[model samples]
Target: MDARLMDATFSRNQPSDARRLYDDRAIRYDNSWHPRFARHMVELARIHSGERVLDLACGTGLVTYPAANAVGPTGSVVAVDISTGMLAQAKAKQADHKHENVQLLQHSVTDLQSLLQLQGETFDVITCVSALVLLERPYEAVKQWATFLTRGGRMIVDVTHPESQISLITFERVGRKLGRPVPFYRVPFQSPDDARRLLEDGAGLRNVVVHSVSQMDIEGRDDLQAYLSDIQHPRIEQAFTIGDADRLFDKHITDWAAQSLANDDIKQKARAVFREEWVKLADASGQIREVDEVFVAIGWKQ
Candidate 1:
């Protein structure tokens, strides 16, 4: 979390790292935070039956599978990702769900133009969700992706508000407490204007529109803890050995607690206070609630 450490982590945001990280995470990625917003993107795109669709960075087929269903068997979906692990999982899901309209491809977005040419294809709808920020030059990438769309075809891109998730906030808080800086690898697309500019101006797409969607969900306390525990923070493996990092984190928490509380009784009281604060985060379901905002940008190929 030190500046140098953070920089090192950010440097690993290349295609190779993404492949390895996602390969390890393919089995669990769908069950994680991303799929929650994937459905919304598919819905917003309004993919119609018989339309040809391309799902870029289609991790575990979250958006791809749904889009296939929306388009029905008459349509087709080309789902591509850099990670073989993710594509494998997606293929498995595609088989299990019987989404015969979907096809899987392992290619980075950087190579999409050439790949499309090799396949001699174009699409009616092109979607890249929660993965644009990972690109080194999102503007250029968008521009390239747009070239693959048919005239009047729609291109949809979505990104999360950088600070909107509870897990992110918790990581930042803990980092600050320990005098470390939590690093974000993705380029921040934190506002609607950001999305608009990237699409309409950067990509030269016409009739661009951006929409913001907010979702709140209640999670059980134990469930939240387990979720946090499994978080493989970007480049975390390079930072510290597995159990060592958790031990260091626990020590920091202990030190912070000791400095803030006078005795065991006060420490217990402090714990209760924090627990109530967390509980207050819950919605009517009496589960810990986390609120997040997702921005979806739509543009048409002119």
Candidate 2:
């Protein structure tokens, strides 16, 4: 995804960035976070051949692709997002796979009525993944989405668990620096209880089931270590958040770039310092004591 596109969507238009970023970063996201999150919904929906599914905020076909596959040749997936760039990437990806079951659209969850109006359609199942947190009014969005589901049809949503927003901190060794404390992060709610109540009891969706999952990358995977190093990469100035902390220990790669390149000794020391400091921070935070949980809420249309 191009940074320009990301900035255009997220930073430029605060209200509509969700659609834009998904369009811009849709392809990049598939390799990073989409597959892991999509599995839960795909399983819950139990997409059978010939069934129809609506993937709201489908962002570059992460959930859409799998759902398309599950439904086999007979099923069709209407994957919607606001970003055309993201949809373009998804289309490119689909072209590569020769998948005919997936259809990409430029749409948002809040405008479901208009979307339905355009397509003259409804859905048997609707799924959204990690895209609801940005909604200014999630309840209203859910209520609108409810109209599209047939009775007994399912709506599965995955969002940042409220509990996942809390920060927990602690210390560990950074190379030779012993007992330096670091930030530990945790979320606040396993699920949004209030939202769940409103949708199930208030809005009339039924049989809401919230499932929690923690996909940890701390151990036994070279890929994760490489990815973590990149995430904490010095050139990246943006804060990577876990839980509700305002900031984590700074990864000031820019500050050390020149010295690190000019002197092997400097680079070694820099790596050691960062490694120990991050370890201490993670250990001190006490986040490792418990698995970080992401919530998946599944319900039937009333």
Candidate 3:
């Protein structure tokens, strides 16, 4: 990787789970339900012809390509993400599709002013999807990015409700028991009102509209292997119950335990509590589901 990408990766000060997802899981991202949400975020942005767009944490150009199409040759879309691997995928897709209007930047979303001020540029719209909660200072990040929006320009972002990803929730619960708290991201965007507060209070945005998609998206059960595959690959929504516990533990949780720097006691206790929690999450038919309610909020600069 180049120095810029290296800085983008190592300098952001994000949570370790962000690093795990961007570095190791970027290639497998589109396999999850993220693309669906990304499309929804852009569709709601309502970009116009000849408008400039900034897409933050744009993994593999999910939002970029569609926004590029909306902007056409007369406009440009700058898609930024911290992961070189994710940008590489996006670059390949840009090449194959011949999208000349899109620029993929391997940069941290946390620092955009210096990144764009060099060009004296501002955007008509800014988008970030499925990424805000990963930041160490998510609201501050929003306020910083909002400064790059032109007068009356819109900022669009999405955050899942606290109940969305049960796997991470359960993992963090186990972490608390072991005295090492996994980075908990469930405190914000629990409702449409929460999303609006982040925009209005943090960014001083106006006319904020919070759209609650996936409100009705209840958890559904799958086999153990399939559920593991979803979380192992970083599902858009996570942690369902059911299936073979041994395979789930060996394949996914074992690595998690190691990464958590588990002593034998921690490992054994973690496994026990994880299994207990996992079993508790399952239904009578041995299936688990996630209530992945997501809020896509759009607000305009005053």
Question: Which portions of model 2 miss their true places by more than 4 Å?
Answer: 1-15, 116-119, 165-192, 201-203, 217-291
Better of 1 and 2 by lDDT: 1
Candidate 2 local Cα displacement, residue 121, angstroms:
1.4
lDDT of 2 by residue, 29-130 (tens): 667545655665687667777788989877767788888888878878888878777778778779766458777777666777776433567788888776
Task: Supply candidate 2's per-residue lDDT for 16.
Answer: 62
Per-model lDDT: 0.65, 0.55, 0.70
Write one digit per residue (lDDT tens) for candidate 3, span 101-152.
8888877787776684325778999999878877768789999888889999
Candidate 1 per-residue lDDT over residues 1-302, each given as its tens digit: 22222323334345765675578678877766566567767877888999999999998899998899899889999888999999988888876766588888888886776674326678999999877755657888888888779998999997655435533433333433443423322334646788888889777888988776543333542222222211112112112222232343334433311222223434344444434434434446554333355667899988
Model 2 residue 28 lDDT score: 68
Model 2 scores worst on lDDT over the 10 consecutive residues at 179-188
True-structure RMSD, every candidate: 11.5, 11.1, 7.7
Candidate 3, pairs of clashing residues: 219-289, 219-290, 220-289
Assess candidate 3 and give its TM-score to the true structure: 0.74
Off by over 4 Å in 1: 1-13, 116-119, 166-188, 215-291
**Candidate 1: Cα lDDT at 250:** 36
